[model samples]
Target: MRTEKEYVQWLMSVPRVGYLRCRKLLEQFGSAEAVWEAPAQELLQVPSVTRNVAEEILVSRQSYSFQEQADFLKRTGIRVLHKKDPEYPLFLLQIHDPPHILYVKGEFTLLDDKAIGVVGTRTPTNYGVLVTKNLCTELASAGVTIVSGLARGIDAIAHEAALQAGGTTIAVLAGGVENIYPPQNSSLARRICKQGLLISEFPPLASAHPGMFPVRNRIISGLSRAILVVEAARKSGSLITADQALEQCRDVFAVPGPITSPLSQGTNDLIREGAKIITGVADIWEEYPDWQANYSHKMKDEAFQLNPEERQLLETIGYGGVHLDHLIRVSQLSQGEVYRLLLEMELKGLVKQLPGQMYMRSSV
Candidate 1:
């Protein structure tokens, strides 16, 4: 017996039943099961369901295999999330055309609700690389989930930085999650599955093509509170993401780059056109006072049980890791005192010690 969800999955699998068409069918019939039971004439009554399309749906339904779909999803460790599913991102629903179905790998937590899309040219200048790393690392360390397409350059850098910061990230793929594009990022995609998430609107194992990139760009922006363009040419896909962000009523942020560089033109144009100019993570935070306040409150809550000295040390350690020598100098505490406090804090699980005697707040 086909479950209601399997019926919806079957409906999605029908030829020519794109996101909009699928949505229309659901709206008209109230459920995929109802759509399946409806006669060809009834299916045709739904907007955009032409005679051919209705007939195709009927033909496809007879051939579709729910068990095969279930086995594929299980084999790939992918979860099929419909728009009506509680796990579907609430922000994505606000977009003009949210994908009716998302194939997701890994987990989505409440932390993902605070996300920023980081996009840029696939071939970036040294300056672009630096800016992307700094901004993404800071944003991730601040508990903002970094969202980006799993392309080379800025997107890969963003995901790497977030993982390095011990923070969450999400990769929105142009292809299916299992069919990682560019091939070079296969290792990175695997890493993301362990620490973050990989999501796509396409069926699992579907290979990406040129046409799917622009369509994939919308979800990158849709899933984020804002979109940050690090570097882009006068004509680039990054601009498409920024445009989608604006259309979705999400904030668009751009890093100002040298006017002499072609890579900077798109971002400069965005800044000139009233997109927020992001000099640093603080600039991004300024637009979301509630996020800043909430982060501050979280820090305070975590420190509520700590003594003054411990709290001071934790504050000094900050979000990013700091060297023991730097902590001692900045805290103006004796080497022996700093060492003793760090050991105590580590034991308390409030701080984590990294390679090179670096310390960072553990909660982030």
Candidate 2:
């Protein structure tokens, strides 16, 4: 006998059946198994269930193999999460049309709740790349899980930076988690699975189509507390994510760029339209003071002891690399005082000095 979830999976596999349709059927029948067993007339009674869709559901059920689906998931180590499942993302659930089923290929944890979505043009300029790397690296180091669509340019850079920072990230795919689109990103997808997650609403083998991308953008914003656009054209898909973020009541952030660049048009417009302007991770943290508190609590939980001045300096440094000049200016400490604190923190393995007089929090 198939489980109720297996029946839901079967319903999902039927042609013309989508998240909303599946939801309607399940709500009317009370269970996916009931929907599976529903007759043509009964299925048709559900709102938006046409005769053709009803027929498809019935016919597909006869041919669908629950055993095969189960075996495939088990073999590939994919996990399924329904909206009702407690393990499903809490933030995602707050959105209006959350995915009915999430196909996960990696670890998902509560830490992901502190996520920020980073997206931009598929073909980014050098300046865009620099901004993405610096911001994402810092955000991840600060324990903010970076979320993106796993596209070619900025998305890939964001994921790579997060991993390099030894932080978590999530890639929301337009296609199946197993069927990585833009095949070049296959290796990056694998890396993300080890450190974060690769998730989709589609099944493991579902191929991507053009229409799937906009649909996928909602999940990106839905999972994040805020969405950041590093670079985008006047008409770019990254803008769609930002729009969805606003609709979902999630914060929208944009990195300002040169006015002359077409790629910056979207982001600059966002800044003009009331989206937060982010120059660095400090700008992001200013929006979420609770995150700072959480970081401090986390440090205390790990038993890392520090005096008031040391704590203040560490907070100023944040998780990302900060220039010594910026540190001294922000902390309002004298040059000698900042240097002494940095040296002490470095020796204690709480911070590391990078070249160019930059400092960042150490993993310890």
**Candidate 1 colliding pairs, count:** 0
Compared with the true structure, all predictions reach lDDT values of 0.83, 0.84
- Superposed model 1: Cα runs more than 4 Å off: 27-30, 38-59, 110-112, 293-364
lDDT of 2 by residue, 1-364 (tens): 6676677788877888866688788779888888877789888788899999988988997798888999999999999988888898888889988887888988877324699999999899977887787677667766889999899999999999889878899999998999999899999999999999999988788888888899999999999999999999998999999999999999999988889999999999999999998755656667897775534435432433578888888888878889999988888889998987886565334677789999998654
> Which is the leading candidate under lDDT?
2
Query: How well does candidate 1 match the true structure in TM-score terms?
Result: 0.74
TM-score of 2: 0.78
10 residues in a row with least lDDT, candidate 2? 295-304
lDDT of 1: 0.83
RMSD of each: 9.5, 8.1
